[model samples]
Structures are given as C-alpha cells and as structure tokens.
Target: MHKRLSELAFGESGTVRYILASRHELNCLGVRVGKHLTMITRQPIKGPVVVAVDGMEVAMGLETAGCVSVEVD
Candidate 1:
C-alpha cells in the first residue's frame, strides 16, 4: 500500500516507491525507488523523522518525509 514515509510508525519497515522532492537531493540522502527503510523515530513537535536506510540512519524533515511514498512491509 502506498503511504507517506512520515506516516509510518516506529519500527515499521517499508520500501521507497516514489519521491516528490528534487531527485538529486533525495538521492544524496540515499532515497530512491526500491530502497527499503525502517522507521526509527520521530522527534516531537513535527520534527525530523529518523529512518534506517541501507544500514544507515537518515534524518528527514516532516515535509520531506511526507513527500516520500512507501510500501509498507
């Protein structure tokens, strides 16, 4: 099912299916189609979302996270 990355709960795993941001910028952070990620945590007050991508933890702002579509696994 397609859902925003920010909508994923902690410890939930998902595969990146789409990116709505600048591809180059998202790519720099290792976000791309077919990449699997796991939600680690989200800071309070609409803060950044921390996700595990390719064995590395990546911090993405709520806006950016909302732009990423994922398929929950």
Candidate 2:
C-alpha cells in the first residue's frame, strides 16, 4: 500500500515514488522525492535512519522521512 514517509517504521521497506512539496521544501532539505531510499535500521525512539541510497548510508531525519513516499517492495 502507498503510505507517507512519517508512516514508516523500523524493519519496514519501501520505495521512493515522488515528493509532494514546493521548491522551498526541497531547498531547505537537499532531498528529491523520487530519490531511491531504503531503511537500513532505526533507533528505539524517533531518529534518523541508515537508508541505503545508491549504495550509501544516508542519515535522514524524522521530518525528512516525510519527503519520501514508498510502497512495499
């Protein structure tokens, strides 16, 4: 099912469909909606995740997580 980034949890896997925001939001955080990102691992509470993007671990924040929309892969 399609869900927002904020809805994702640890051990959850999905794909980046597209971002739904203005250019301001993009500039504020150097992230594009269509960017391919996968959750590697997360913290106990709310924190950044070790997302596998282009074979790199990009630490993303809880807020930024909303930028990525993913589906079960």
TM-score of each: 0.94, 0.61
The runs of at least 3 residues in candidate 2 whose Cα sits more than 4 Å from the true structure, single-residue gaps closed, are 9-12, 21-35
Candidate 2 residue pairs in clash (backbone atoms < 3 Å): none
Model 1 accuracy (lDDT, Cα): 0.91
> In model 1, how large is the Cα lDDT of residue 28?
91
TM-score of 2: 0.61
**Tens-digit per-residue lDDT, 1-73, candidate 1:** 8889999998999899989977777889888889999999988999999999999999989989999999998
lDDT of 2 by residue, 1-73 (tens): 8776667665566766776645355434444555655667765578765666667666666666666677756
Q: After aligning candidate 2 to the native by TM-score, how far in Å is the CA of 2 from where it should be?
A: 1.4
Which 10 consecutive positions of candidate 1 have the poorest summed lDDT?
A: 21-30
lDDT of each: 0.91, 0.62
